[model samples]
Target: MARNTERRSALADAGIRVLAEQGARGLTHRAVDVAAGTPRGTASNYFPSRDDLISALVGRIGERLTPDPTRLSSHAARTPDRDLFADYLRDVVRRLSTDPHVPLALFELRLEAARRPAVAKALGAWRQRAFEDDVAFNDESDLPGGRTEIALFHYAIDGLMLDNLTAPIDSGLSVDAAIDELVDRILR
Candidate 1:
């Protein structure tokens, strides 16, 4: 059983590497087996279908993006620090830049989820949970735009991620400057 699990993990990691380097269409059990250094038939032993393999791969990637609810709750206990937001933006950008494969995996999973209802539902649940927490944290009571404004603010961030993933993002903008621009736009 342990050996089987190890083989499964190896296959999943291999799949990520393949998808990252060649995109989703290039993924195959033979490719993953070669990448993982496992026997050609090893992938089939664990992942009987391509969808099954992809589901595992997507779940693993999604887990990375799913924020810990408890962590946000703990942060909420402290007073808002403007500097922290800048730090977070910097961290996010750094991660995006350094881990180019992460966004690629995310894009593949997101696109696949669009075609599969079950996958889409799961992704939607994960996204909703994350968005709910953000909405709770940034609640602006009686503000004209209120939650809609917050949602749009988040939408812009998502758009930024997609744009950066699609093209080389300029390195000139400091994280603080970017956050300040976002805050300025949203606050007004």
Candidate 2:
């Protein structure tokens, strides 16, 4: 099958939607083709196997979740302090929450990873790469947090997103306030 970047990306996006709506079990080449409104076997042509399709989904998720460089530059232009860090956190929350399906799809992938070692390997690599990239960005921007602190924040973010996206422990919780407090208390 000839490679089509645009169609491949569309299929990947459709795969994400299927995963988000129907979960990992529902993720299939046919499902992706259906979601993308492409002909049957289109997704299979793009991703020959389930693993290949999953790998494509993982890469696409990273691309979709990447923080905007222009926005990051704006944040970096400000003082590299706790408040600034909180602002970055706010941006993260905004990004994840704005597109609820993306995070939901990510959660589905993470769940599938626990059962399938192949999925785990692919997902783990993507996560590790993202973590390293975030750490590098922090180091470059002279952020207050180091590796350990960033790791802590990463853990906190996962929990926060899971809770907020699924069923929040507190329905009336203010995410911004939580982020502010997290920055104030977590970052030194």
Query: How do the predictions measure up, each by TM-score?
Result: 0.69, 0.96
Task: Tell me the spans in candidate 1 whose CA falls farther than 4 Å from its real position.
Answer: 1-7, 66-78, 114-119, 133-150, 169-172
Q: After superposition, how far is residue 51 of candidate 1 from its true place, in Å?
A: 2.1
Clash tally, candidates in order? 0, 0
Tens digit per residue, CA lDDT, model 1, 5-50 = 6566667878887888877688888888888898887877777787
Model 1 TM-score is: 0.69
Clashing residue pairs in candidate 1, if any? none
RMSD of each: 4.4, 1.2
- Shift in Å, residue 39, candidate 2: 0.6
Question: What is each predicted model's overall lDDT from 0 to 1?
Answer: 0.66, 0.90
